[model samples]
Target chain A: MNKILTIMWKDVRVLFQDWAAVALIIAGPLVLALGLGLVTGAFSNSDAPTIGRIPVVLVDEDGGQLAAALVDVLTSDDLSDLLAVETLSDADAARARVAAGDASAAVLIPTGFSDSFTPDMATGEMPASVTVTVVGDPGAPVGAAVVRSIVEEFAARADTAVAGVRVGLTQLAGSGAVSPVELPAVGQSMAAAVFADSAAASAASVIRVETRNVTATGESFNILAYFAPAMALLFLMYAVTLGARTLLSERREGTLARMLAAPVSSAQVLGGKVGGIFLGGFIQLAALILLTTLLWQLNWGNPLSVLLLVVAAALAATGWGLLIASLAANAGQITSLGMALTLLFGILSGSFVPLNDAWPVLDWLSRITPNRWAMDGFVALAAGEGGAAVLVPVAALLVMAAVLFAAAALFFRRRQGALLTA
Target chain B: MTTPILIAKDLRKTFGDLEAVKGISFSVLRGEIFSLLGPNGAGKTTTINMLSCLLPPTAGTAEIAGHAIPGDTLGVRRAIGVVPQEIALYDALSARQNLEFWGRLYDMRGQALTQRIDEVLEQVGLADRAKDKVKTFSGGMKRRINIAAGLLHKPQLLFMDEPTVGIDPQSRRRILDMVKELRDGGMTVLYTTHYMEEAEELSDRVGIIDQGRLIALGTQAELTRVVGEQETLRLYLAEEAGAAAAQATVAAGDGAALPADGGLTLFNGLPGVLRASAIDHQIVVNVADAGEALPAVVGRANALGLHVRSVDIEEPNLEAVFLQLTGRGLRD
Candidate 1:
């Protein structure tokens, strides 16, 4: 509608009126992405940034089967091209090596690491978790990240093997292929034997994908590709929140009432505000993508897919912004909560660091935020997963948008009798 | 005479148990300035909000330019322009931009919207500052542009709800003149203000509102008539003389016998003087003839060793009428 467009036009013009805000929403992220890229050394003339094989020390504190087996994985053929592996008996020695910049990172396998992984029949702890500490030097950021990524890749494959065994054993007991009374003992023995110091066997019968594969594009994990979308999305929440909060500000300023007093309906006003935020977010995203591509020389593949991703990301973020605006009691609340949520989403979505190469729990938790979907789509594009590869994340983003929008609509209706400022 | 531009029959609005606008009604003839004269919290702004379709009445009905309220909210909104008590222009935008933005909302576009924006900017005398951001403008300039925003679409009826509340006198004067010009050009207006002088200076018919009800509605002459043939002669006395004069008069008894002496006696004996009361720094005389009583009052004050600092004579006004109706001063 003309009225809706008019409303959006007014809002957008108002948003652009403050040059500082425009700069903050657009250029701030561009600088951060580039700065982080330079910090991580994710820029180069090649299709991907190049870093030589990083020197890594593997410290096996636990002489258990899992620790020895994981150390074997660190020295495995798949990681040998990117990592020069060394054995350290003491974690302190490994830490000293990394701190001295003699090594990119040190992977310390703590005591009880494998003992936890082996199912305990008496303790009844079926799915076990143990912390694997990776200490990295600030001097070798990308190499350190790569070293850390390899350990996570090995851990992921082991987790898959254990989970597959548990599921199979549970099914067997249920189907009477194995006696119910013997299921726990059967699982404990199978797990203990599989991961024992002598048997370093990993299962292939379960669904698995190589966590990080150095593909044909000459690209490895680049920080700029990750941070560009991460920082952009982090501030995109703010820009959208800023836009949404103005609806309340305008209401207090009497401009909203004045507009409502005109030949305009409430729906038109909402359409304009939501549309303005949606469009502003997309512009910010596109501009950041372009600016990062130019400034950092980063490859964000499949232009069409990137555009689609930006739109979907904007939709999901704007929907959240509207939901926050509706639920927030005032402008101050919207601002503070928006900022807090942005940081939270950023941290949870692995914007600062890839959660994929970190804890599996955190990686799973990232799914709840739109930033995760957006980051996943962007990371996919960066890795040369063409247009169609991004569809799953885009679909995920749209579903989030639909859910958030429905909730926002319900809240808006409930609060309709009161003004936005209220 | 042809048809009323706006009419309301028993419009009511309640927020919880507190009734903001009681069941009340009035009509505005085409091309007339109908002023709602009331102090703050007398439901003036609430009434303006209701008539402008900014607030839906809890009960009753109304029609603006033949379009009904609530049921035809969009229609009513289309027929009216509302300049709220607050200066509602976007401070971030330019004067011209603010006008253009609001103009488009009223459905004007392209050259017509541009031309109308220019016309309204010029109308409010802000044509020169069209490009300057409104936040950079002076308060009066902002108020002018605020009014300019409302005038963009040239609606059939305009609602100016205390548009001159907090501004310099020069700007207030300009806005008053602009309101008159709009009415002269055949635009019906519903103006609300607590200032009796503003209502007296602008309205063809005044509606005196008090506590959610219209207490009186008539022309200036009719409203003034409510207080009767009365003139107040305010004789400002010196600070020391204020209490002395009143005590002197009370001692002199009834202020009618003249005390058979001189000094304050002459004030009691002044012809057409009905009652002389001194309070604070001013001696007020309710008189039958102000013109004839002024000289004698001043002479008596001088004779009584009371310095007549200044003197003022006021004709009975809507303030007096409001006092007679509500038993309290309008400003009270």
Candidate 2:
């Protein structure tokens, strides 16, 4: 244990001695968070940095039942506090409003949008698909994403309703309950009722949460609370990578062999390396949180939970670092793979953008990265949620750390002879 | 007789089909500087690694300070100190800090570790630079600290593997002197080097290895006796003369001699000349007596139209012993 600590201390010392690495891994995130916060007007004391009512223009060319349902859902009382809806006649003009940044997004309902949902009896098949397009502003990604989510939900429910009606009509035709000539009319009637029912249910549930949230928090959300942890978690990976790099560098320089030659076991040596990486990451996160609090006056909520989240996040990030080191052939390879993983994880975890609900696939994939879980916990905490809100994210981060550490250990064990040999 | 501090029996290591160490064995007596002398890739470092427990031998057994290799690895490691061929000290750390870390790994702590660090630093002649980062030190200074780290725990045995490599002559001399001091202070060192001169100067007993085999092992006098009553006559020829001699010798086609070795085997059967070989610009001829063989050797070179710039007759040394045993110079 003493030997492990000794090696750990040595590795940490080496990591900090490289001034360039220290600046890159520690100070770089602080600067970026501050800059992003300023740009996003997160520091404005008069107004909270909440994603308030999103401005959206609707161009309903369909003039059909389904299009009217979508317009109703968007302009519903439940979403009134979340989305500021407007009606436009021209599709091109609605898109222009989005492009001009006058609105967060524009929902363009095509001319034959509703006709696609009804089947023709002669063909016994659905009409050619006409898609509804949501043109979003590049500047307000969160607001634009919210508007897009609503449209996507409406489309998904309509598709399900049509499919349900098709199944019902097919069964009715097989049972000789309806004639083939009347099948199309029956399918259209069933589809409209199913679509309206599902749309109302989905809208009531999904749109209700937004209204309740805005009301409960009084539209208060700290943007820095999001960017601060996002930036910190992004660079925490870099810090652990830098630490993991020393495992190979020390071997190349003969220091690893020197350590192994002492009374220390290979387990002790590796344990120290793992501990060192975790410690480096932990210090980087804790220091960033403290610095951002002092410099940016950002509150990270529930000190105990924040500390635990930092530890779990650092542990998971260090596990990734170890996995990269174990797979890489040398210090140079570790650096290349580490940098690539850092950036890839940063983008995937929505460190630069809130993407937790952007796409279902993206949200699921983001679960594999520590940045996502840490960011979620931090964002929740910043929104004035209690410590209980971080429980799931913390648990997920711990599980990620365990699995990655086990995999890295197996790899290290296989290469133990090659690595520890002179 | 002195007790053997380290004993090995048929230690061998094979990397796939390549046999790096081919079942060779020897022992080092307590309180002696036992040098393993060989050329590069000659299994000297491999032997050191195996004994130090860094690598397990494939087909042999060895014990260091009563700790067996492969079984009691922790025990062996605890009893031994390894100064690797590379300057292994952390360049980002100060000399004292690096020593402190290595010392603690050996379970040294508190005042004892601190005082031991100071002692080792002073012994390496870098006490004044203890606080300076290792990167700020010269190549020689780093090498000294590298050795100092190994000496921190004051183990029963120290393995210094080619410690003087790539350093200036003055620094190499200082390290040599430091090794002598350690030996005089009752330290047992297992030193490995490719330099014959270093072995000749440092080893109380020398083991000459080649092609993963221990060709010869004895005291300097004992090993030199392998080339009984032989003297090396070194003939330094001018560049043109050397090249001309090499071409002529190859044209003669005595025994597939390479021109890179100067191919100087013209005086094979000269009176009192036992054998002849070439190294660089000098042709070395092993003879029974320099006085009897010099005239004929020089005359033979002249007959071959080779100009002899100067000549020197050297006493039998480790190089001559290696040449006699393996038919090649230690640097080959």
User: TM-scores of the models, in the given order?
Assistant: 0.77, 0.81
Worst window of 10 by summed lDDT in candidate 1 chain B: B257-266
What is each candidate's fraction of native interface contacts (fnat)?
A: 0.81, 1.00
Residue-level lDDT of model 2, residues B198-221, one tens digit each, is: 999999999999989998999999
- State iRMS for model 1: 2.2
lDDT of 2 at A109: 96
What tens-digit string does per-residue lDDT give for candidate 2 at A45-127?
56545666789999999987777778888898777878899999998899889879899888999988988988875766899
Q: In terms of DockQ, which candidate is strongest?
A: 2
Q: Calculate DockQ per candidate and list them.
A: 0.47, 0.66
Instruction: Look at candidate 1 and tell me the lDDT of residue A80.
Output: 62
Segments of candidate 2 deviating more than 4 angstroms: A37-101, A105-138, A142-222, A353-363, B236-248, B251-255, B258-264, B280-282, B295-310
lDDT by residue (A259-339, candidate 1, tens digit) is: 889888888888888999888888888888888788767788889999999999999999989999889988888998889
Candidate 2's DockQ: 0.66
